[model samples]
Target: MLSLPRSRSLLAAAAIVATVATAGSLTYSLGLGLTPCELCWYQRILMYPLVAVLAYAYYTADTGIYRLVLPFCVGGAALAAYQSYLQVVAGGTCTFGGCAAVYIRPVTIPNQSLIAFCLIGLCTLGLAVRTRRDRT
Candidate 1:
């Protein structure tokens, strides 16, 4: 009956998201043979940092660092959500060539990556909110 701390939960969630994202990228590169575009690269740049940041925050028990990291997670999530919609729902009509080309043909979307990132953001946000409530 041991209760885990919020920071630990958030860190675990971020790690899971990072793991899934890495796997998806590998799958696309090795299995689907799809190359990522500039926007996709940018999204990855923003996302990869969260794994480290959240891990550090959890290790240090620094809710303040978590607060800072949350914005980046949210931004990455927003980008991923938009890309997923464009690729899956919109049928790859997005202006980005990589998104349209890779996703348009089979209507394939990186839904797992999108969901993982969004969940990371949401869980971190929830943790941050709860932390703030406890402090106040």
Candidate 2:
């Protein structure tokens, strides 16, 4: 088991990842003028709050912050996964028009969001598991 400070550091790292994802998506929309699709909006909704909440929890050294982050990360991952599926299978036939899967190379917003959601979700799960272990 990691020390409390080490656990908090991991949470802070998760917060950072979430914040970067939020910034990237916001930049794609606002800075580049590329409108987002429904799944994108869903992912953003889940990603945005984590930046604030996780940061606060990290600073407060909240050992149980995983409880707060799990739901959002899971929902975000689901939306991202769905978006990714639409990109691959539907081939840009998303409900809100379409989604892009290749921007420059072969990385798209949906894919990026999925990666971020997975990372954060797993991190939170690790924290939850470790916390439970400590309690026992």
Give the number of the best model, judged by TM-score: 2
Candidate 2 lDDT over residue span 38-117, tens digit each? 77887888999999988998888786989889999989899888877887787755656455544624577788899999
lDDT of each: 0.67, 0.83
TM-score of each: 0.74, 0.91
Off by over 4 Å in 1: 1-4, 30-32, 88-90, 99-107
Query: 52-109, model 1: which lDDT tens digit per residue?
Result: 7777766776666656766776777777777777765665555575654454233444
Q: Looking at model 1, which ten-residue stretch has the lowest summed lDDT?
A: 100-109
- Where model 2 places Cα greater than 4 Å from the true spot, the runs are 92-95, 101-104
